[model samples]
Target: MPVVVVAWVLLILLGWSLVYWPHLPSGFVFGSGLDSSARASWTDAVYLSAVTLATLGFGDIVPADGWLRIAVPVEALLGFPLITAAVSWVLQVYPALTRRRALAVRLSLLRRVDTVGLVAGQRSVLAASVLENLAMSMAQLRGDLTQFSETYNVRDADQNLSLPAMLGVATELTEAARRSAVPDVRHAGELVEAAVGDYLDVVDKQFLRVGGSAQKIAAAYADDYGQRIAPAVSGG
Candidate 1:
């Protein structure tokens, strides 16, 4: 997103510079006491445009003519809001992205524990506690998925840590728990499965209402998981 904003800024600067280039001789001026040999070129126009848009008044260049006087300040005024909005968007998005990554990590850990327990046939109290904790984590993750679906605006395919991926992980963990001989683990797995189902329903409803890139991402993720990751994780 920041890259998009930067591209837009560059394009804006280029456009304004091109518009001002032809008018430079009559409408633009360099600072006083500069050499007479210094004349406005395309490069100079571009530099001035950047300076004005960034509101970086180095004062080495100035607009001398009437129309340019209005134009330069208008560019400077636009600069303030544009830069502020970009910074504010970054500040808002970064934390949300960080939280999503953290949740993915936590789910990965839970899946690992459950897989190990299923393989080892462990029936200890510690295993039960782990199952309980996994169930709780799945519940929390469901809520997080709801928030993510509600708040996130799909910008691109760059965001790979999505609700669908997390759902796949949860499904694997539930299957692991179900295969275990321990009754408590089986019950916990059922709880996780139920929570996951509810969350998936919400995701489906959201996809139906707001069908776009997000829905495409979810469908692609599900297909990939079903064909590749699911068989590997399920030992099929």
Candidate 2:
């Protein structure tokens, strides 16, 4: 997301510089102690673009009357929002990324124990509680991915905190919970299953934009992280 945003800014900078390049010196007013040549260098065009887009007029160069004069303020108007959006992208993305990793960590920890067996026993309520939490986390994680689609590109070094790596395990665990005979545990499992399925649907359609079953899409999503999660995403 950050890369895309910054690229947009630089592209605009270059584009505007090209536009202003042909009309420099003659089209613009030159301040004292400046070389006001008929043919200004590319650097002068770029300098004008940088200063104008940043809304920082150094007074060394000024646009004379005509379209060039009007273009200066227009570029300045566009500059503020672009700079603001660039900063906002970094700030907004990290929180969503943090939440995503938190969910992965939670699901990853569950894989360490036999949650299915524990939920099947008389103390099923305790496991059911955990199952409910997992279901909600899955739902929240899905929402996070949807709202902050950019975080999909933000990867974690540790597989334990990587969404694509551990998400399939969450699906498999939820599937086991769904088969339990206990009403509470089974209900919680169903919730988790539904949440996971919905998550698969979102990632498949919006981000991946591929034509396939949810299982195949989920597998592809995990493949980006260098993990084979297709086997675990079977209960789709």
Candidate 3:
């Protein structure tokens, strides 16, 4: 990500350097210390570009032409705010991913503790509430990923924090609830399943680009994140 940001800044500087190159010494006001040479070299253009983009107009050289005076400060404007926006984008992404990983951990703990209470055909209101909450969480996660596509490439250092690793657990748990004898639990499960399915569709459509069933897309997502989907039980 930093590479991309740097590349963008460099490309902008290079483009503006080319623009300034054509109008060298003739278009610029030079301080007494600068050489009064008739011809300017490419390095002079690059140096000018660097200073301008850095917003440090070192007085030794300044734009003289009307258009260049406007252009130089424009590059300065791009300098501070453009990089600020990029840094802000990076800062925002992790908070969203933190929430995503937190949800995965919550799902993991639920799976470790209760195997049957959620999906064992029991008509518990608590189970229904859990399912609804999971659905809402998954829905919010989907929205985050959609808005910030770059988060898909971020790798979780911890297995417990990897959403791809626990996504199946969510689906299967929701599946069990959908099969519950209780109507409320089943409805809640259905909503969560839809939520999970939408997230899967987004993975396939935006990032994976491997069109197929949800299972295939989920597998591709896991693989990209350096994980493998855990196999479901035969009956599950």
Q: Which stretches of candidate 1 lie over 4 Å from their true place?
A: 1-4, 32-36, 115-167, 173-236
Name the candidate that leads on TM-score. 3
lDDT of 3 at 85: 68
Cα-based TM-score, every candidate:
0.56, 0.77, 0.80
| Model 1 C-alpha lDDT per residue in residues 123-227, reported as the tens digit of each score | 646655655665675566556556555344432232234444544666666677778887777787777767666655555565544344533544554543342
lDDT of 3 by residue, 1-236 (tens): 55677887899889988988888889998998677484387778888888888877687878899998899999888888767868888888888888899987887777676644556657568888888898999999999988887888888867568888877877787778866888888888888889988999998888779998777888888888998664323232
Local distance difference test scores for all models: 0.63, 0.77, 0.80
Instruction: For candidate 2, report its TM-score.
Output: 0.77
* True lDDT of residue 32, candidate 2: 83
Residue-level error in angstroms, candidate 1, position 4: 5.2
Q: What is the C-alpha RMSD of each candidate to the true structure, in Å?
A: 7.0, 4.4, 3.8
Q: Pick the candidate with the highest lDDT.
A: 3
